[model samples]
Target: MSSPTLDDAKRRSTEKLDPERDVETLELAPASEYYVSHPFMRKLLSWGVEARGILPVPREERTDTQYNRIFFIWLSANFNILSFSAGSLGPAVFGLGLRDSCLVILFFNLLASLLPAYLTTWGPRLGLRQMCLSRYSFGFFGVIVPSIFNLASMCGFCILNAILGGQTLASVSGGNLSWSVGIVIVSVVSLFISFCGLKFLSWYERLAWLPVLLVYVVALGIGGKHLINPPPAEPADARTILTFASTIAGFVITYSPLASDFTTYFKPDVPAWKIFWYSYLGLNIPIISVQCLAAAVVVAVPTVPAWSDGYADGNVGGLIQAMLRPAGGFGQFLTVLMALSVTANVAPTLYSFCLSFQVCMPFLAPVPRYVFSVLATAIIVPLSIVGATRFYSTLTDFLGLIGYWASAYAAVVLMEHVIVRKGRFASYDLRYWDSPRKLPTGLAALGACALACALIVPSMDQVWFVGPIAQKTGDIGFELAFAATAVFYVPLRHLELRFRPMV
Candidate 1:
């Protein structure tokens, strides 16, 4: 059932004992040389490229201090303008004031950033895709379990991003266009950027965030001038603190699995603290600014409807159009900038997803990342078109479900990084990532994963399924799942280790 890749994966286990046996240490042509040899350029024009895609980035081509630069911009750009308001959702839902909400978000968001930032440290040394790294804990073949979760999660991601982008698109169109049309427009543009591959992605993100940031500043200046006295801050309660903490932590932790996908070009020697602080601050500042604004808008309007697509009391589009209307040409420019924020957010997500597809099905490795991007986009476009309203309507429950599984999975990955790998990463043979005996037994993680799922069900509260325990406990399913996984996995993993050595 296995080929050279299986041999390769098996060889990697023993190869670690002798550094010379590691293949990744060898040199290769520059990334540009490899790029020119491929047909990527032609594909951009007429779509005739038959290039081999998804090559592991070579070490010689790696960046120094710029190791995680693209990721920094990628995260910030994705925040867009609405993200500030969206950050308000949890605080608003639980009735926290602007001051208390900012404090809760600022603290927990930095806390949640820990695991994902830790993951960024693995990218350069391993050069393996994130899912490929799971082979160690889940077994080469057993990796499919998490892969399935990722694929399902990605579906919701594309849909949600499209919905937001559609809103922005519709906003810019002045109601002349349908939201569904905006959805299609954004989906196509996102897929196109994804088709262009990582080189273009890094460049695009570098340029996109500043303009969006500038627009936010302009809006803030105008709005701050007309502000009224705000309501006195509400004192924090246990209920408010716990609910806000879990929700914001859950949201930030969502990036854990996708962390290494963007950092493949970093040199392994990159300082751990450097990666941690850079990624932490990069993600932290943008999200904080966005949420702070969300709070500010609410404090001012007072009547801002209970938060839906930044359009509840004041549609992001309608509000921007009204506020900026006085500035004439400047207003028009700012409106488009706001919409581009949505585009900037959704586009980079497509790249890692394409890599996820390759991990789930290694045979597709040579199929070109662009091919996967287009086909997947096409399949989901129908879902976006037909189910857009359903998804947008139930965003809250949907996010709850997403955060539930995401947090549990993150718990397992964190445990493995600390207890199993011991935080030292070396080169890997990615091709044989599916070899059975060469990987972990898969029993410990899988058994605990199932147990984690069961444990969360009692605490869960969503639109479709609410645990009875949630009624009494106030729906702490996400927090419970996160803790439950760590509890079960630690002991079970120890037991599993006694039965079979991962080596």
Candidate 2:
């Protein structure tokens, strides 16, 4: 495979060369060495129908520089029914008042947003997918661990979103449609958007939030008056506070691994501060608003008969339906649209999940990205069908699991970038992304992850297993994981750099 030289880039600009063909050839050639020899396939790729897989996009191929779009991208992805459901968990399950839940949502989500916000800057700077960038610290082989975890997290998230979307459809239909059918419908819609690749996904996400935002406002208007005043009870115990905080953190922090996937097309010169704030404000605004609204509304579940009955029937979907029941047909219509909003949430996850597989399995790297979107949809549709009844349990446990590794993973990667490499973007060799020998040994990363997991186990609060320490202190496991990984990673990375420096 031939890399595009400065001479080649210059020739394309100066001479009468077909710029599209040259760019396509440059980008797709590295996916498979034989691609350079196949004129028919090269022409096909030049048409841009085939989605680019895991290959690092060349700087010349990157033309997007709309930093402001980062705001809408994350806004649409997170401003959905899933976030509303997450907020309801505070009072619905954890037994906290509206004020306490609001506190948890504001404080923890603000702090958690920082990790992924910073990672979003890497997209333009590195021109690699998030998992592809993981090769820097986790090595080509060791990245498979996070890849697998990310894939599972993606699937888990899809299932949760699909189930809720389906339940809402079912709710709107007055139970005429089965929840399974609704799940399949939303999953297919999301798969279609993701199959169109990054450009289409960006376009869809940019506009997707408008209708959903209107619906959220209506739901809040109708239900906001129902929020209990003078508070229900005193703040919960420390264990409960920590457990709920970790749950919310788990919900938002999982985006860290998928952060760079969206920003890869931006021109590398985009300011880091611009990317950070756009991504940060984009992620936090909807999260804080919808979550706080849900939390406040959920406190009415026990006090309001309609809400209580709604929750009893369809979990989060039912509660929302009852909340909006006052608006009559308009309320029902909004409920349906809110359910459909899952596509915005699921599309990006479905898109990035395919990239993760390409990064993890080399054979799959040559396969077009849309094919993996099909594969992921096939897997998620069935799982969502089977897991439809276990919404709350799945939400709590899966989110807690995400909190465990994502925190540790974020800590190690951030430490490697800031402390080990002194936050120097030039230190990254994008050309060596696919080269194992040129990457880190991953001894420090693996060691740090292992140490964090060992500590995480005893502090995790879950349905299946409650660690002894967790029984006493609640789910501080994620915090412990972050602190532990940072402590272990820096020294170990320094040692590895001293002995096994890459050229």
Candidate 3:
């Protein structure tokens, strides 16, 4: 058969696209080469494809101004409202005595939120995706280590979030509906939204925050009345405060790896200060505020009613209902709003998980990124249905574990870009994944850092060598892991390069 023309190839590729197909197997070399070779043609194609939803904004669309890039980064990072809502558990589990708890949250938020900007800014400047950027640290084929790890983590997160969304739905509907049904419903909805791609996801995220804000206001308005009338208060202690602080730290630090994946889309024109302020204010402040409110509610009403023998079964919804009950019809409206807000929270979580997976498996031949996203959602929904509760329990520990690895990965990247090479490396060099001449020191550093972090993580669970620290400090193992990785890798990298120069 004769080689297919460009138009024929495009037609065949589009025709063969399947939602269930694995994107890792897609054959896109011809298309990729066509765009790479023809500069003017590539710009036209990019606009056309992006317009039709087949392509994302090309690098050329990015503004070179620092402020513009920062704004985009801020929007991307702040868009995920789930981060704050999930983190409410920190104060709930640890209680408010730990004044340091807020500090820990602030520190972790700053680190995870800002450091990734530095790494990802390099990506847009170089015009590469996250996985491709890993080539600098992980080395040609070595990039697969982070890629595979990230893919697994993303899938696991999708399942975990689906499970949470299902549980929340089940709680609101009362025990008449099974948890499995709720999980399935949530999974299907998430899958449908994700299958629609970034455009739909972006619109949903922008609107989702509105209901979340409404729920917060309504819940607080009602809950505040209850606080004024005042039930008996539980005495706060030192241990409680420590745990709370540590938990906040753990929650924030755990999200560091995921930050870069979002901020990579920022226009280069965005300023760093704008990115920093918006992320700190728009993202971190709102999130922490929610957590504080949740903590206050738990404190005010120490005894959470058990529905179906589960603690806090109705606590969240009850808070909303209490607020709505005062409004009568308005209250009912707020209740519905609360439910929708919960579902909206899941949208960004699922969307981000899909994007991370797409980056993780860029080598797929037949399936495209959107298809992989849909497939991921399908897999997550079923898992959530069967194991939603158990999955929820595992999320804290699982994120903690992932946190260690993510911190290690971040440490390696920071050391390489900021200290080791002083940011002198060429970004385009990442595309040459087969280069054998490069030192694999970055991969080695990451491995060593991961091992160190793994060793310390169990301590955070009140299990091993440093159980007392975790028990006393909450699960601030993330801080320990991040500190250890940076300290170890930075010096180790220097020694490795000096002792064994790559000639």
Candidate 4:
């Protein structure tokens, strides 16, 4: 059956055109195209709010050629203090030294970024948001489960960025400003930028890298003397190393759902390999550089009595403050800039979260995407405040949890592209996106996903619970999840096409 959306027919007509003729354009959708057709709301255009939802972009409207922005999009999103803080977890929490933590960050982060890079190429060809693309594999209804999971992951990312930004803010303010206040400040700015939508976000991200890169370089220079390979605080066992590696993998892999969200307006003729490498390098450069530097600094924390004390008082933020303490007033200035830089991270997560939310509940598609951005900020502020209480534990636990489902979901999509669709561009068939009757029932995809999630339970190792297999093998749940999902999905999909040829 066809979706009851007001523009379904318009979308169906557009899908008949050659997708390649459409080149890059990220203009704001007209206010009348929005779900609520009011006269005054047309003024929203003056405010620059992007009104586009899950609908595929038509060929005629695709007109922008600034394809190079794809690199800056991901680079700015990840190159922030939070990425630095994630690396510090290795030395500060897991007891890994410079050698081990850097190794894990290098290998796993590069490995995890590959899938998201691969998915980026789909945007110019399909003109659909990442989650919208999933309807082909999971059908209309079944796509909600994975979309919901993606929402949770993006929310978790926002919360993490807010808390880190808040911590940095509080650290710079000494005892005057509260962490909660910092969270509200960061959340507010992020919400404002996201409400402005894609054009403004793209412009902001393109330049965000300069300031963040400057601060990181200053931080490295200030702490350069302490970058040493200190002895591990405790023994580094296979389980602990595996868990650390997976956490790093989880951080990069989390971007899979939002991969195509930024590239939907690129010209289809923009070489696919350019999209892939730009995206891959964009993610790799910041994550590896910041995380590795943070790890090295944390490894020397024990040797510096002041830094150790700072870590004791403030966790990640405290450690950062202590390192910058030697620089005095100038350091405080940089700290505040570092705190605000988190908006770079928050903008993309908030923007994509709204899209994913609409994908989950289609009824909300008529509402401006910015309205959901406001709602998401409201939810995130409170959670960020609460999660700040146990920052390290929350970081690890949340990463592990999201990694489980993200890995499984990504595996299914990759398998569908290769085995079922045979890596052909035309196989996506945008007309089928909202038509459930023409789509696969999604029973096989959902079944495979459910089985993968279930089997991974036995291999899960988290602070709240530990599985029998995980106790012996460590937290290899992400690895198990990807493997299990691929194995189950291939056979299940084969049988599905056999029984239901039209699907």
What's the CA RMSD for each of the models? 4.6, 4.9, 8.1, 3.3
- The C-alpha lDDT values of all candidates are 0.64, 0.83, 0.50, 0.82
What clash pairs does model 4 have? 23-267, 24-64, 24-267, 25-64
lDDT of 4 by residue, 1-503 (tens): 32234464444353254545422232324334554455454678655668777767655455558887888988998888889888987877677868888999999999999989999988887778999888788877888999999999889889989999899888888889999999999999999889888889999999988977777778778888777446555667988888888788889998998899988878676788999999999999999999998888777877889888878844677777777777899888877878888899899899999889988997776677788899999999999999898888888888878888889888998999988888876666665666777777788889998898777998888888889888888888999899999999988988888765533
> How many backbone clashes does every candidate have?
4, 0, 28, 4
Q: How well does candidate 4 score on lDDT at residue 434?
A: 69
Off by over 4 Å in 1: 1-65, 91-95, 226-228, 232-237, 302-314, 390-393, 426-432, 498-500
The TM-score that candidate 2 achieves is 0.91
lDDT of 2 at 228: 43
Worst 10 residues of 2 by lDDT: 15-24
lDDT tens digits, residues 2-44, model 3?
A: 3333344444432112233111112223333333334554464
Q: Name the candidate, 3 or 4, with the larger lDDT value.
A: 4
Candidate 3's C-alpha runs over 4 A off are 1-58, 61-87, 95-112, 117-120, 171-177, 228-243, 263-265, 303-333, 342-362, 390-392, 424-442, 454-459, 462-476, 494-503
Tens digit of lDDT per residue, candidate 2, span 413-448?
899899887887766755567767889988889899
TM-score-superior candidate, 2 or 3: 2
* Candidate 1 CA-lDDT value: 0.64
lDDT of 3 at 427: 24
Using all chains and alpha carbons, the TM-scores for the candidates as numbered come to: 0.84, 0.91, 0.74, 0.93
The C-alpha local distance difference test score for the whole of candidate 3 amounts to: 0.50
Per TM-score, what order, best first? 4, 2, 1, 3
